[model samples]
Target: MKRTVLPFVLLLAAACGPRYGMRVPDKLVEKLPYESRIELLESENDLALAIDTVDEASNEVLRARDAIRRAKARESAAEEEENRAADTASREVAKLAIEEARARVTYLRAKQRLNVGLRDVEQLALRCAFARYELARLQSTRKAKVEGSEKLDVKKYEGQVSQCEAKVKEERAELAEDSAQEKTAREAWEVKKAALAKKTFDARASPYVENL
Candidate 1:
Protein backbone atom coordinates (compact mmCIF):
# COMPACT_ATOMS: atom_id res chain seq x y z
CA MET A 1 0.00 0.00 0.00
CA LYS A 2 2.83 2.44 0.91
CA ARG A 3 4.67 1.76 -2.38
CA THR A 4 1.50 2.31 -4.42
CA VAL A 5 0.82 5.63 -2.61
CA LEU A 6 4.41 6.77 -3.28
CA PRO A 7 4.01 6.26 -7.08
CA PHE A 8 0.70 8.18 -7.08
CA VAL A 9 2.30 11.12 -5.20
CA LEU A 10 5.23 11.21 -7.70
CA LEU A 11 2.75 11.23 -10.59
CA LEU A 12 0.92 14.19 -9.01
CA ALA A 13 4.20 16.10 -8.59
CA ALA A 14 5.12 15.49 -12.22
CA ALA A 15 1.72 16.71 -13.37
CA CYS A 16 2.10 19.87 -11.28
CA GLY A 17 5.45 20.80 -12.87
CA PRO A 18 5.56 23.97 -14.97
CA ARG A 19 3.84 23.49 -18.31
CA TYR A 20 5.89 25.95 -20.44
CA GLY A 21 9.39 25.27 -19.22
CA MET A 22 11.22 27.43 -16.68
CA ARG A 23 10.09 31.03 -16.27
CA VAL A 24 11.69 33.68 -14.09
CA PRO A 25 9.37 34.77 -11.33
CA ASP A 26 7.82 38.19 -11.93
CA LYS A 27 9.17 39.59 -8.65
CA LEU A 28 12.70 38.69 -9.68
CA VAL A 29 12.33 40.25 -13.16
CA GLU A 30 10.60 43.38 -11.88
CA LYS A 31 13.71 44.75 -10.15
CA LEU A 32 15.91 44.39 -13.25
CA PRO A 33 15.61 48.04 -14.35
CA TYR A 34 18.88 48.80 -12.59
CA GLU A 35 20.63 46.14 -14.60
CA SER A 36 19.25 47.10 -18.06
CA ARG A 37 19.59 50.57 -19.56
CA ILE A 38 19.72 52.25 -22.94
CA GLU A 39 23.17 53.45 -24.02
CA LEU A 40 23.28 56.82 -25.76
CA LEU A 41 24.75 56.68 -29.26
CA GLU A 42 28.27 58.22 -29.24
CA SER A 43 30.07 57.33 -32.46
CA GLU A 44 29.53 59.42 -35.63
CA ASN A 45 28.29 56.33 -37.44
CA ASP A 46 26.00 55.57 -34.56
CA LEU A 47 24.60 59.10 -34.65
CA ALA A 48 23.81 58.81 -38.35
CA LEU A 49 22.23 55.42 -37.73
CA ALA A 50 20.17 56.96 -34.93
CA ILE A 51 18.88 59.65 -37.29
CA ASP A 52 17.91 56.99 -39.84
CA THR A 53 16.21 55.02 -37.12
CA VAL A 54 14.19 58.07 -36.00
CA ASP A 55 13.12 58.74 -39.58
CA GLU A 56 12.03 55.16 -40.02
CA ALA A 57 10.17 55.05 -36.75
CA SER A 58 8.34 58.23 -35.62
CA ASN A 59 8.94 60.38 -38.72
CA GLU A 60 7.86 57.67 -41.13
CA VAL A 61 4.60 57.16 -39.28
CA LEU A 62 3.77 60.83 -39.81
CA ARG A 63 4.92 60.70 -43.44
CA ALA A 64 2.67 57.72 -44.13
CA ARG A 65 -0.26 59.72 -42.77
CA ASP A 66 0.53 62.61 -45.11
CA ALA A 67 0.78 60.16 -48.02
CA ILE A 68 -2.75 58.92 -47.43
CA ARG A 69 -4.12 62.43 -48.03
CA ARG A 70 -2.00 62.72 -51.16
CA ALA A 71 -3.21 59.33 -52.39
CA LYS A 72 -6.84 60.35 -52.02
CA ALA A 73 -6.14 63.61 -53.82
CA ARG A 74 -4.51 61.61 -56.60
CA GLU A 75 -7.58 59.45 -56.99
CA SER A 76 -9.77 62.55 -57.21
CA ALA A 77 -7.48 64.06 -59.83
CA ALA A 78 -7.42 60.85 -61.80
CA GLU A 79 -11.19 60.93 -62.00
CA GLU A 80 -11.12 64.46 -63.41
CA GLU A 81 -8.40 63.48 -65.91
CA GLU A 82 -10.53 60.55 -67.11
CA ASN A 83 -13.55 62.84 -67.43
CA ARG A 84 -11.48 65.34 -69.41
CA ALA A 85 -10.39 62.59 -71.76
CA ALA A 86 -13.96 61.51 -72.19
CA ASP A 87 -15.04 65.08 -72.95
CA THR A 88 -12.44 65.23 -75.73
CA ALA A 89 -13.53 61.90 -77.23
CA SER A 90 -17.21 62.83 -77.47
CA ARG A 91 -19.25 65.71 -76.10
CA GLU A 92 -22.56 63.89 -75.75
CA VAL A 93 -23.48 65.10 -72.23
CA ALA A 94 -21.21 68.18 -72.36
CA LYS A 95 -19.47 66.63 -69.35
CA LEU A 96 -18.47 63.05 -68.74
CA ALA A 97 -19.95 61.94 -65.40
CA ILE A 98 -17.08 61.74 -62.92
CA GLU A 99 -17.25 59.83 -59.62
CA GLU A 100 -16.32 62.86 -57.57
CA ALA A 101 -18.79 61.94 -54.87
CA ARG A 102 -17.28 58.50 -54.47
CA ALA A 103 -13.81 59.96 -54.60
CA ARG A 104 -14.65 62.25 -51.68
CA VAL A 105 -16.05 59.32 -49.75
CA THR A 106 -12.90 57.26 -50.35
CA TYR A 107 -10.77 60.19 -49.28
CA LEU A 108 -12.79 60.48 -46.11
CA ARG A 109 -12.31 56.80 -45.33
CA ALA A 110 -8.57 57.07 -45.82
CA LYS A 111 -8.51 60.04 -43.48
CA GLN A 112 -10.48 58.11 -40.92
CA ARG A 113 -7.94 55.28 -41.04
CA LEU A 114 -5.15 57.77 -40.60
CA ASN A 115 -7.04 59.29 -37.70
CA VAL A 116 -7.09 55.89 -36.01
CA GLY A 117 -3.33 55.63 -36.36
CA LEU A 118 -3.01 59.14 -35.02
CA ARG A 119 -5.09 58.31 -31.99
CA ASP A 120 -2.98 55.25 -31.24
CA VAL A 121 0.16 57.38 -31.17
CA GLU A 122 -1.61 59.99 -29.13
CA GLN A 123 -2.53 57.38 -26.55
CA LEU A 124 1.07 56.22 -26.54
CA ALA A 125 2.12 59.76 -25.73
CA LEU A 126 -0.45 59.83 -22.97
CA ARG A 127 1.04 56.64 -21.53
CA CYS A 128 4.47 58.25 -21.39
CA ALA A 129 2.94 61.31 -19.75
CA PHE A 130 1.39 59.06 -17.12
CA ALA A 131 4.70 57.39 -16.40
CA ARG A 132 6.30 60.77 -15.87
CA TYR A 133 3.40 61.85 -13.69
CA GLU A 134 3.88 58.83 -11.48
CA LEU A 135 7.60 59.50 -11.14
CA ALA A 136 6.95 63.14 -10.31
CA ARG A 137 4.42 62.16 -7.71
CA LEU A 138 6.89 59.81 -6.10
CA GLN A 139 9.58 62.46 -6.18
CA SER A 140 7.39 65.18 -4.72
CA THR A 141 6.41 63.08 -1.73
CA ARG A 142 9.94 62.04 -0.89
CA LYS A 143 10.67 64.77 1.68
CA ALA A 144 7.90 63.59 3.98
CA LYS A 145 8.98 59.97 3.60
CA VAL A 146 12.67 60.63 4.16
CA GLU A 147 12.53 58.69 7.41
CA GLY A 148 10.75 55.80 5.72
CA SER A 149 12.20 52.88 3.82
CA GLU A 150 14.98 53.27 1.22
CA LYS A 151 12.45 52.82 -1.58
CA LEU A 152 10.18 55.58 -0.28
CA ASP A 153 12.91 58.17 0.35
CA VAL A 154 14.03 59.39 -3.07
CA LYS A 155 17.22 60.87 -1.62
CA LYS A 156 18.40 57.43 -0.56
CA TYR A 157 18.72 56.60 -4.24
CA GLU A 158 19.54 60.12 -5.35
CA GLY A 159 21.71 59.18 -8.34
CA GLN A 160 19.30 56.55 -9.56
CA VAL A 161 16.37 58.83 -8.86
CA SER A 162 17.91 61.72 -10.70
CA GLN A 163 18.87 59.52 -13.63
CA CYS A 164 15.40 58.09 -13.78
CA GLU A 165 13.88 61.59 -13.58
CA ALA A 166 16.10 62.69 -16.44
CA LYS A 167 15.00 59.65 -18.37
CA VAL A 168 11.36 60.56 -17.81
CA LYS A 169 12.03 64.14 -18.83
CA GLU A 170 13.65 63.09 -22.09
CA GLU A 171 10.87 60.62 -22.83
CA ARG A 172 8.15 63.15 -22.05
CA ALA A 173 9.75 65.77 -24.25
CA GLU A 174 10.11 63.36 -27.16
CA LEU A 175 6.55 62.11 -26.82
CA ALA A 176 5.19 65.65 -26.60
CA GLU A 177 7.05 66.59 -29.77
CA ASP A 178 5.64 63.53 -31.49
CA SER A 179 2.13 64.38 -30.30
CA ALA A 180 2.49 67.92 -31.60
CA GLN A 181 3.64 66.66 -34.99
CA GLU A 182 0.74 64.22 -35.11
CA LYS A 183 -1.67 67.03 -34.38
CA THR A 184 -0.10 69.16 -37.09
CA ALA A 185 -0.19 66.30 -39.53
CA ARG A 186 -3.88 65.77 -38.82
CA GLU A 187 -4.61 69.48 -39.27
CA ALA A 188 -2.72 69.60 -42.56
CA TRP A 189 -4.49 66.50 -43.81
CA GLU A 190 -7.84 68.05 -42.90
CA VAL A 191 -6.99 71.25 -44.76
CA LYS A 192 -5.88 69.36 -47.87
CA LYS A 193 -8.95 67.15 -47.81
CA ALA A 194 -11.25 70.14 -47.57
CA ALA A 195 -9.51 71.87 -50.47
CA LEU A 196 -9.65 68.68 -52.51
CA ALA A 197 -13.37 68.34 -51.86
CA LYS A 198 -14.05 71.83 -53.12
CA LYS A 199 -11.71 71.51 -56.08
CA THR A 200 -13.15 68.17 -57.13
CA PHE A 201 -16.66 69.51 -56.73
CA ASP A 202 -15.81 72.48 -58.95
CA ALA A 203 -14.17 70.24 -61.55
CA ARG A 204 -17.18 67.92 -61.74
CA ALA A 205 -19.65 70.78 -61.76
CA SER A 206 -17.73 73.00 -64.16
CA PRO A 207 -19.55 71.78 -67.27
CA TYR A 208 -22.90 72.65 -65.71
CA VAL A 209 -21.41 75.91 -64.48
CA GLU A 210 -20.22 76.73 -67.96
CA ASN A 211 -23.66 75.92 -69.41
CA LEU A 212 -25.43 78.17 -66.92
Candidate 2:
Protein backbone atom coordinates (compact mmCIF):
# COMPACT_ATOMS: atom_id res chain seq x y z
CA MET A 1 0.00 0.00 0.00
CA LYS A 2 2.86 2.41 0.88
CA ARG A 3 4.66 1.75 -2.44
CA THR A 4 1.44 2.25 -4.47
CA VAL A 5 0.73 5.56 -2.68
CA LEU A 6 4.28 6.77 -3.32
CA PRO A 7 3.98 6.07 -7.05
CA PHE A 8 0.66 7.96 -7.19
CA VAL A 9 2.22 10.98 -5.39
CA LEU A 10 5.20 10.99 -7.81
CA LEU A 11 2.84 10.91 -10.80
CA LEU A 12 0.91 13.90 -9.42
CA ALA A 13 4.11 15.85 -8.93
CA ALA A 14 5.23 15.10 -12.47
CA ALA A 15 1.89 16.25 -13.84
CA CYS A 16 2.13 19.58 -11.98
CA GLY A 17 5.81 20.25 -12.64
CA PRO A 18 5.50 21.62 -16.18
CA ARG A 19 2.94 24.30 -15.35
CA TYR A 20 5.37 26.71 -13.75
CA GLY A 21 8.73 25.14 -14.45
CA MET A 22 11.43 25.90 -11.87
CA ARG A 23 10.50 28.76 -9.57
CA VAL A 24 13.51 30.45 -8.08
CA PRO A 25 12.84 32.32 -4.84
CA ASP A 26 14.20 35.83 -4.45
CA LYS A 27 15.75 37.41 -1.35
CA LEU A 28 13.41 39.23 0.98
CA VAL A 29 15.23 42.57 0.65
CA GLU A 30 15.25 45.02 -2.29
CA LYS A 31 13.93 42.68 -5.00
CA LEU A 32 12.26 45.50 -6.99
CA PRO A 33 15.46 47.52 -7.38
CA TYR A 34 17.49 44.49 -8.39
CA GLU A 35 14.91 43.38 -10.98
CA SER A 36 14.50 46.93 -12.33
CA ARG A 37 18.28 47.28 -12.78
CA ILE A 38 18.36 44.04 -14.75
CA GLU A 39 15.48 45.21 -16.95
CA LEU A 40 17.20 48.58 -17.53
CA LEU A 41 20.38 46.85 -18.67
CA GLU A 42 18.50 44.54 -21.01
CA SER A 43 16.47 47.43 -22.50
CA GLU A 44 19.62 49.50 -23.03
CA ASN A 45 21.22 46.66 -24.98
CA ASP A 46 18.08 46.23 -27.09
CA LEU A 47 17.94 50.00 -27.71
CA ALA A 48 21.50 49.84 -29.08
CA LEU A 49 20.51 47.13 -31.53
CA ALA A 50 17.41 49.10 -32.56
CA ILE A 51 19.58 52.13 -33.32
CA ASP A 52 21.88 50.01 -35.48
CA THR A 53 18.89 48.62 -37.34
CA VAL A 54 17.64 52.14 -38.01
CA ASP A 55 21.02 53.14 -39.43
CA GLU A 56 21.18 50.13 -41.71
CA ALA A 57 17.61 50.68 -42.85
CA SER A 58 18.36 54.31 -43.62
CA ASN A 59 21.30 53.29 -45.79
CA GLU A 60 19.16 50.74 -47.61
CA VAL A 61 16.54 53.42 -48.29
CA LEU A 62 19.21 55.63 -49.82
CA ARG A 63 20.46 52.80 -52.02
CA ALA A 64 16.95 51.95 -53.14
CA ARG A 65 16.23 55.59 -53.97
CA ASP A 66 19.39 55.74 -56.04
CA ALA A 67 18.38 52.59 -57.89
CA ILE A 68 14.95 54.03 -58.64
CA ARG A 69 16.52 57.20 -60.00
CA ARG A 70 18.88 55.24 -62.25
CA ALA A 71 16.04 53.05 -63.50
CA LYS A 72 13.89 56.10 -64.27
CA ALA A 73 16.74 57.72 -66.23
CA ARG A 74 17.26 54.56 -68.24
CA GLU A 75 13.53 54.33 -68.97
CA SER A 76 13.51 57.95 -70.11
CA ALA A 77 16.43 57.31 -72.46
CA ALA A 78 14.72 54.19 -73.81
CA GLU A 79 11.53 56.17 -74.48
CA GLU A 80 13.48 58.80 -76.40
CA GLU A 81 15.16 56.13 -78.51
CA GLU A 82 11.86 54.32 -79.22
CA ASN A 83 11.46 56.07 -82.64
CA ARG A 84 14.70 54.40 -83.81
CA ALA A 85 13.53 50.80 -83.09
CA ALA A 86 10.15 49.57 -81.87
CA ASP A 87 10.96 46.00 -80.70
CA THR A 88 14.11 46.95 -78.77
CA ALA A 89 12.37 49.92 -77.16
CA SER A 90 9.50 47.71 -75.98
CA ARG A 91 11.90 45.23 -74.41
CA GLU A 92 13.97 47.95 -72.80
CA VAL A 93 10.88 49.60 -71.33
CA ALA A 94 9.67 46.26 -69.97
CA LYS A 95 13.04 45.63 -68.38
CA LEU A 96 13.08 49.07 -66.81
CA ALA A 97 9.57 48.56 -65.43
CA ILE A 98 10.68 45.38 -63.72
CA GLU A 99 13.77 47.11 -62.35
CA GLU A 100 11.74 50.02 -61.06
CA ALA A 101 9.25 47.68 -59.42
CA ARG A 102 12.03 45.79 -57.66
CA ALA A 103 13.65 49.02 -56.50
CA ARG A 104 10.35 50.28 -55.14
CA VAL A 105 9.89 47.02 -53.27
CA THR A 106 13.32 47.38 -51.73
CA TYR A 107 12.55 50.93 -50.70
CA LEU A 108 9.26 49.88 -49.09
CA ARG A 109 10.95 47.04 -47.22
CA ALA A 110 13.60 49.43 -45.91
CA LYS A 111 10.94 51.83 -44.77
CA GLN A 112 9.17 49.05 -42.92
CA ARG A 113 12.41 48.06 -41.26
CA LEU A 114 13.01 51.63 -40.15
CA ASN A 115 9.50 51.87 -38.81
CA VAL A 116 9.93 48.67 -36.80
CA GLY A 117 13.20 49.94 -35.39
CA LEU A 118 11.62 53.21 -34.32
CA ARG A 119 8.74 51.38 -32.70
CA ASP A 120 11.12 49.15 -30.80
CA VAL A 121 13.03 52.17 -29.56
CA GLU A 122 9.85 53.81 -28.34
CA GLN A 123 8.73 50.63 -26.58
CA LEU A 124 12.10 50.15 -24.93
CA ALA A 125 12.08 53.76 -23.86
CA LEU A 126 8.80 53.15 -22.09
CA ARG A 127 10.14 49.97 -20.49
CA CYS A 128 13.20 51.82 -19.26
CA ALA A 129 10.98 54.52 -17.80
CA PHE A 130 8.92 51.95 -15.92
CA ALA A 131 12.06 50.32 -14.67
CA ARG A 132 13.33 53.65 -13.46
CA TYR A 133 10.04 54.23 -11.68
CA GLU A 134 10.30 50.84 -10.01
CA LEU A 135 13.83 51.49 -8.84
CA ALA A 136 12.87 54.91 -7.52
CA ARG A 137 9.89 53.45 -5.72
CA LEU A 138 12.14 50.91 -4.09
CA GLN A 139 14.53 53.63 -3.01
CA SER A 140 11.69 55.68 -1.59
CA THR A 141 10.38 52.68 0.29
CA ARG A 142 13.80 51.91 1.70
CA LYS A 143 14.40 55.51 2.69
CA ALA A 144 11.08 55.73 4.46
CA LYS A 145 11.90 52.58 6.39
CA VAL A 146 15.23 54.00 7.59
CA GLU A 147 15.27 55.78 10.92
CA GLY A 148 17.58 58.48 12.38
CA SER A 149 19.75 58.73 9.25
CA GLU A 150 20.34 62.24 7.96
CA LYS A 151 21.71 61.19 4.58
CA LEU A 152 18.89 58.74 3.86
CA ASP A 153 15.88 60.51 5.30
CA VAL A 154 12.19 59.94 4.44
CA LYS A 155 12.04 62.97 2.13
CA LYS A 156 15.28 62.21 0.28
CA TYR A 157 13.77 59.84 -2.31
CA GLU A 158 10.96 62.20 -3.32
CA GLY A 159 12.94 64.04 -5.94
CA GLN A 160 14.19 60.89 -7.57
CA VAL A 161 10.70 59.43 -7.60
CA SER A 162 9.25 62.61 -9.10
CA GLN A 163 11.82 62.63 -11.90
CA CYS A 164 11.18 58.99 -12.69
CA GLU A 165 7.44 59.62 -12.75
CA ALA A 166 7.94 62.48 -15.17
CA LYS A 167 10.00 60.30 -17.48
CA VAL A 168 7.27 57.67 -17.45
CA LYS A 169 4.66 60.28 -18.30
CA GLU A 170 6.69 61.56 -21.23
CA GLU A 171 7.10 58.10 -22.66
CA ARG A 172 3.40 57.38 -22.37
CA ALA A 173 2.57 60.64 -24.11
CA GLU A 174 4.51 59.59 -27.21
CA LEU A 175 3.05 56.11 -27.37
CA ALA A 176 0.09 57.07 -29.55
CA GLU A 177 2.22 58.87 -32.10
CA ASP A 178 4.62 55.96 -32.27
CA SER A 179 1.75 53.55 -32.84
CA ALA A 180 0.31 55.74 -35.60
CA GLN A 181 3.63 55.94 -37.42
CA GLU A 182 4.05 52.18 -37.26
CA LYS A 183 0.55 51.66 -38.60
CA THR A 184 1.18 54.03 -41.48
CA ALA A 185 4.37 52.21 -42.38
CA ARG A 186 2.59 48.85 -42.31
CA GLU A 187 -0.28 50.08 -44.47
CA ALA A 188 2.05 51.61 -47.04
CA TRP A 189 4.14 48.48 -47.23
CA GLU A 190 1.07 46.33 -47.69
CA VAL A 191 -0.36 48.53 -50.43
CA LYS A 192 2.91 48.68 -52.35
CA LYS A 193 3.46 44.96 -51.97
CA ALA A 194 0.00 44.20 -53.32
CA ALA A 195 0.43 46.50 -56.30
CA LEU A 196 3.86 45.04 -57.06
CA ALA A 197 2.45 41.54 -56.73
CA LYS A 198 -0.09 42.36 -59.43
CA LYS A 199 2.61 43.74 -61.71
CA THR A 200 4.70 40.63 -61.13
CA PHE A 201 1.75 38.46 -62.04
CA ASP A 202 1.16 40.46 -65.21
CA ALA A 203 4.82 40.24 -66.18
CA ARG A 204 4.95 36.50 -65.55
CA ALA A 205 1.81 35.93 -67.57
CA SER A 206 3.29 37.69 -70.59
CA PRO A 207 4.56 35.22 -73.23
CA TYR A 208 7.22 37.79 -74.19
CA VAL A 209 8.68 37.86 -70.71
CA GLU A 210 12.40 37.10 -71.03
CA ASN A 211 15.54 37.07 -68.89
CA LEU A 212 15.52 40.88 -68.87
Best by TM-score: 2
| Model 1 lowest lDDT segment of ten | 35-44
Clashing pairs in 1: none
Among these predictions, the greatest lDDT belongs to 2
Q: Model 1 over residues 1-212: C-alpha lDDT tens digits? A: 13533353234324524421121222432333331212111222332333344335555456546655665565565566666665453332222223333333444444455455544444333333323332333443342233222344334334443454465466555555445555565555444444444544545244322110
Candidate 1 residue spans exceeding 4 A from truth: 1-98, 146-149, 152-212
- The TM-scores, one per candidate, come to 0.31, 0.34
Please report how far candidate 1 places residue 73 from its true position, in Å.
20
Which TM-score value belongs to model 2? Answer: 0.34
For model 2, residues 138-183, the per-residue Cα lDDT tens digits are 4544544432223343343344435444665675565566556546
- Give the clashing residue pairs of candidate 2, or none: none
State the C-alpha lDDT per candidate.
Answer: 0.39, 0.44
